[model samples]
Target: MVKFRYFPDMKDNNIRNFCIIAHIDHGKSTLADRLLEYTGTLQAFQMKEQILDDMDLERERGITIKSHPIQILYKADHKTTYTLNLIDTPGHVDFSYEVSRSLAACEGALLLVDASQGVEAQTVSNTYLALENDLAIIPVINKVDLPGAQVESVKHQLVDLTGCEEDDIILTSAKTGKGIPELLQAIITRIPPPERDFNKAARALIFDSVFDNYRGAIPYVRVFEGRIEPGQKMKSFATRHVYEITEVGKFLFKKIPTQELKAGDVGYIVAQIKNIRDLKVGDTITTLENEAKSPLKGYKEMKPMVFSGLYPVNSDDYEELRQSIEKLQLNDASLRYEPETSEALGFGFRCGFLGLLHLEIVQERLEREFDQNLITTIPNVEYHVTDRQGNLFIVDTPSKMPDMGDIEMIEEPYVKAEIITPPEFIGNLMTLTQEKRATYVNTHYLDPSKVQLIYEIPLSEIIYDFYDKLKTVSRGYASLDYEFIGYKPSKLVKMDILINNEPVDALSLIIHQDQAYYQGRRLVQKLRSLIPRHLFEVPIQAAIGNKVIARENVKALRKNVTAKCYGGDITRKRKLLEKQKEGKKRMKQVGRVQVPQEAFLAVLQLGDEK
Candidate 1:
């Protein structure tokens, strides 16, 4: 048994750059763990499940939220050594942007499918993304040892997905280590190595970046055209800012400093980048002395599909929150935010996310990593509003919308959604989409048991509780994938939430006129339930401009003033009661209602309960 070793003169032809792409919980991370063990990257004492997943949230949820890059050495035939760089990508739809970024840096991908579950929605979507990137794909059927494994059936589906012959698919149980050696052999033979060109001008693509308090922004790059070394002055092709490289290294679960990085290498370059903003992800880094003529066809900017307001629980911490968000933005290029103030929530940022899950993950990271407590308002989608003045503007928050009297048109983003599920739930799915204002487009049978449903639906509808309900209707067997089609005109109005006649800007929403009443009523009722009773009467009203559509009052707490005058004269008691009533009226005039955080979150689950 020959062990892996680092060879100084490893040829470019011996390098294989690939990524593992699959649906959520189909064992992408598990397979990654096995590969690291087989290649002697980590000893028995150092190995762990999902060793590449660094975040606590990912470990808890058994999911991969971020794309992790790792390098391993594999020795084959007990003689020759090979260098392999593998990027492990997230499988959830919300993190598809992460997958896209990983795909941009690789030359091939392992399209993993579950033998029992067959092909899922994300599997299809990611396979298409890999094809679009012109990546060589090796189809792998994982968990073949399961009792319910449908090896023959899944192989047929992979044939449709990859257009490959049935015998070309590799079957392996990543847990039991079955067919591990065969898969490694297939990778070396099937996937083509990256082309090396050290003679060209040095160019590297910033696929991702991280902020270091000491060194500043450390960019994770893929060397494209030439080689980069320490002490070389490199300038950002996008920003035109120059800096000398301080260090460069690769990660084998941990950063190991290297003297230089050549073409086709994926590693980190530390130039003591201070701002973090200066090293933008997807930007190119080139040598100032001999710069590349053109930048790599980089990744497209990922547009956020959902928008929400994130405010600090304590107003004094606003500045710290801003700083924390900026640092987080360094790691997440898909996360977008801007300074925004709400009359009710005070100063905060209006953040944009790829989806609701992305928003939730960011909030968790902020709270955990920065120790910042945040209040998130109702999630909404960016809308295009044409005012009465004929000016078109984007409104991500309801507070930014003009009054109903402005008399203008509005457009909301729409998505073409694909759902794969068993045909038994067709009726329930139809009803579910109907309630969400989804238009039926087409349906096709993937095989005999699975049916693929396509619908054009508003982006807003799919952001909320839809994924949960989708699973419910299909008995946890449904998978969804969607893409933004374009904006479509809709009759939408801004519904405001008021507490004691003062509008709560954070709780406002832009809803279709037909749904404004019902949704507003549900939201108002939820607020009434979540808010505690105050000394003064608090009226929770959902209104359109001035006219109230739904109202719920939290009755003021009362103290028995008459209890003190047990046997007093009737006139005396009446006088005391009148004085108490007058005092109560004055308190109502000057009093402020302290709404709890739960009230702010009520809008998220307004439609969840009956």
Candidate 2:
């Protein structure tokens, strides 16, 4: 085992670092609020629901977008006060990286499950992640006060899933603050303290960070060995940029300055680094004087799994959109945007995201936070294309794909999807999966009423509207989680959209051969409804290379006319009608069909066919 410098002044037994993990809407944030009140960390007047969730977006959406860590002073049964660092994590699968980093910063985790909802897909996924980190998991059933809650049933499920005793599962109603004190006491007594090594160099793991206009980049770190204080010169292991720490503070809804953050403690460090890009999350910070021999493990650069193009509704906002995305990327490292132009949409950025939810959140933030009107293209999954020369290439956009003759094979990403639902929805769920080309893995019974189904499906099949359909078919009882397994060979084709026989590159898509026909027909049908009628009939077609497979027509508005009189009058009317016909032909050649913003978004929600 590697040894590190330990701080003799601070005792490791006094610190308890742990994070709370749960499914969305499982009262995880509510429980965090209750814990703060119970521990007297925040006064009753200062207490707010989801105190850790400070972002306006998070509050509005009723979810945590970023993980927050706070320090609380708790008095144990032995009459001794201990410092507990509680990190509140986002429950969404899109933010799983945040959860993983939070777990890596702690020695224990609070596995909070909703009593009413029982064990959900996210809860199970998070539990396994915690176990992988070797964290001591404390299973707690939340929202027991709700009328529909089945505490015993949930308790049995927890016991079976966690292999912990039924009696060990603590039940709490976050709204009423019941069982909070017991939960707090259990945290102090049951969770083991972090290990310390004072003899080695000072090292801290930077799990999360944010930009501060007044001070600069402030990184929230968990000190695993040694200590950090004001005036200490620290350098990031990954970036190698060094800066002197100006101040260290604990997050108490706001920043609260502390003397020093020692081993096993979590707090924020304000350095002179101005650019947020320099302060990388998941990087280790060690003293410049005696740097740690090795950085802490599990540091990885975040890569986006989904790619989409964001064009400004008004072309003038292109620069504004670019600047806005740059500022947003400071807060969200997962976001990747590069300047791109489309033939139909003009100037925009091709942005990459972690998942569909991530893509939506970024788009929503761009619109709401930056006040920019944007047009987003359909989200696409990264595909692997192998050429005839045995070279592999990643295709993120349809236009980037190589020629069919040059490409030896094409592979699309697949994920291991886990769905937890009521037994009644099994047949419907199966049908939905089968339609999406999902292969069965296995099924397990959580209890007499609930079932967990596993399947392997292509990532592209669900990227658009799978979750919405699942919730509809399952009657809102089903919850799902998925992780990318790998890429598999697929028979895929590029489906293109044409307006007036001219192919629109922005509207083209690379889809499976089996889905090409249906997708093509649906897109054309939707486009015909969105594109306004021109002077002449406009034909919208879906084509594969040179062959057209589906077509729809937007009929032109007719103009009322009256002609014919006497024999000489009829000849004059004929000449007039000929002139009108020539004019109409000229108008048809010059006039361009305008497709509205709704037309582009309409094709995104072609849900699973019933």
Candidate 3:
């Protein structure tokens, strides 16, 4: 028999690796806190709101930004013990890729459904993802303490929707800790143990990773088989790079180095790996002896779904912004970038992100972490353009689009969306969706007073602040979920911006021909307000195929800099210019005015007027 290594062989069958999956605001984080409290992992005085959501942005936005894994000890019989590895995942569509990776690291999942909201689109989608991963689903109907909770009804919905037995459903309020102990027991009973062939070479999966200034890149891993110790030689399955494990440790809400880690435990490896690209989530790590045939499969690198350009508000801060991006990239592998230069905006970066929230998170982090200001371009979707001769190019920025004569076919992505809302707002919701070029697929009554409306809509239609608009139209009663279906032929035209009748290459866009008129007018109106007044009046025009669909004028500046500078005043003006330059150092200069990136983002919602 092949020698199998074991480390800290603390009871094999008493450990559980699981994640809590739920829709946004369904109390996943809260449930995690309650679990920590009940398990004595946290003292009552030490408990803070949403401790797992450690990032400031997450707490402010009331969303989980990253997947957090915590280990807790629980007891059953007089001598029985278990180590519960609880992975708390982000509850947003933008981070679904992260969710999938987190799910892959576990053998089971706790599907948390809000008792009052029942089954939402995200709930169904995440549950389906978990099922697809073959995870043992432990359905937990949470928020039962809420006044509007319909626990029994939600239990039935879980049974009907997921095909899980009604008796399998566990009613728990992560808030009041009601049914928490039972939920814990159910986890111990229902979840299966990790299967591993200790005889084989040590193999593990990296589900999470972060950059540590002191130790380099620390990858959070789950050992599938065999044992791993500090100083063990290993190679990454994806990058094919070899490294020595500098340290092996477990997360005690924070990192605590342990001597060794074994199968079924979630731990971190301090490898000399410095770059994020070297450590991929879902990539396998294995020993050289009896090396595995291949690394673990099913690891798909994340692709950026949205494109935008970021420029420093001040030319001086350009390098600072670039440095900030590099540091951010150290931790965020999902962000993609390429350096871009514009005649009007100078040097900037064409950055790509998973989605709007991902884009906003990066921007916010840059400002908060680096304390630098930037100017960002409007968010846009990628399009495939083909020339008459069949040459094809994927264009992300409208400024990079080829001339009209060079393109014959344009293709854009489309998505299938399911929106659930109250019956009273069906007409208004339908009208809003229709105006956004959504085609009705089907509608079903989820309950007597609630409805699920299915629509096949162009991804471009909803990519720009559509969720915020949907919430406004539904009065916060609607929940939406969408997935990319495929690409389709679109009558796309490049809308050009004209300042004083001269086309400004910086403000071009690719839009569908059918909606050019309204979109063009709206964009021009938005630019009129966003563009700062200069020495000359600027005429903003949106055009499609040689036709101007909308026109707006930015009136000339009435006053700008002070005309006269006396002795003390001159010093003050110099100081003011220096301060302005310092401020500009954080911003990107677009045209004459130094514009901040937040201003570019603020204009994104200009078209959502009532």
- Report per-prediction Cα RMSD to one decimal: 3.2, 3.7, 7.8
Q: TM-score winner among the candidates?
A: 2
TM-score of model 2 vs. true structure = 0.95
lDDT tens digits, residues 247-331, model 2? 8867666677777777777888988778887876688999877678889998888778899999999998899998999888878
Query: What TM-score, to 2 decimals, does candidate 3 have?
Result: 0.89
How would you encode candidate 1's per-residue C-alpha lDDT over 353-430 as one tens digit per residue? 989889989999999999999998889999999989998989888878988898589999999899988889899899
Candidate lDDT scores, in order, read 0.87, 0.86, 0.81
Best candidate (score: lDDT): 1
Report model 1's TM-score to 2 decimal places.
0.93
Q: How does candidate 2 score on lDDT? A: 0.86
**Candidate 2, poorest ten consecutive residues by summed lDDT:** 1-10
Candidate 3: what lDDT? 0.81
Clashes of each: 0, 9, 9
